[model samples]
Target: MEVIAIQKSAFDGMKNELKELLEMTEKVTRKYTPIFKAEKWLDNQEVCLMMNITKRTLQTYKDKGLLPYSKLNRKNYYKLTDVQALLEAGQPYNTDGNGFTDQ
Candidate 1:
């Protein structure tokens, strides 16, 4: 068996690696935590961030009732489940009732 010397650089490298591992573990843990999933409703900014959409696009959805929402004190709140279902359902572009693109 050979003796391995522990140096400051090696120790620091190990510490950094451990820290990175811990951070990744925390991220994975947090992903399945109930606190994250407890948010049944989402505001506009959160919806935009999750859907990678601009506020204008979100407004368009709201205008067309594509994304169901409820207003509380004049503020709109969308259901997270509904948003997820909409994504899973793969909604198509709206038509102008005459089979023409609404665009």
Candidate 2:
């Protein structure tokens, strides 16, 4: 009877430890899941989609200084903020500082 009690106690302790491990894993996953607000920047594919351009077109824009981008480990990245600024500046509806219009 004592041996059975010892075995049951060990199994209970193991089960409790496994449950704690699973709870910890759940917490870690929730902490690291991606949040949409944290990812406003555009990668190459995102920029292509935004501008309706091909990868080659994006390269040309980068080469011509017409697009804003950054290099991370030799890979290019763009920001939505820069795209918005470019669109605003190029729009015909935009006015100069002196209130003069392009039209």
lDDT of 1 by residue, 21-92 (tens): 999999988875664467688999988788766677778888988899978679888889988987788644
lDDT of each: 0.79, 0.70
| Candidate 2 ranges with C-alpha deviation above 4 Å | 1-39, 89-103
- lDDT tens readout by residue for model 2, 26-76: 997787455325556788998777765567666766876878787766887
RMSD of each: 10.8, 12.2
Instruction: Write out the backbone clash pairs for model 1.
Output: none
| Candidate 2 displacement at residue 103 in angstroms | 20
In candidate 2, position 100 carries an lDDT of: 45
- Name the lDDT value of residue 31 in candidate 1: 78
lDDT of 2 at 31: 75
- TM accuracy, model 2: 0.46
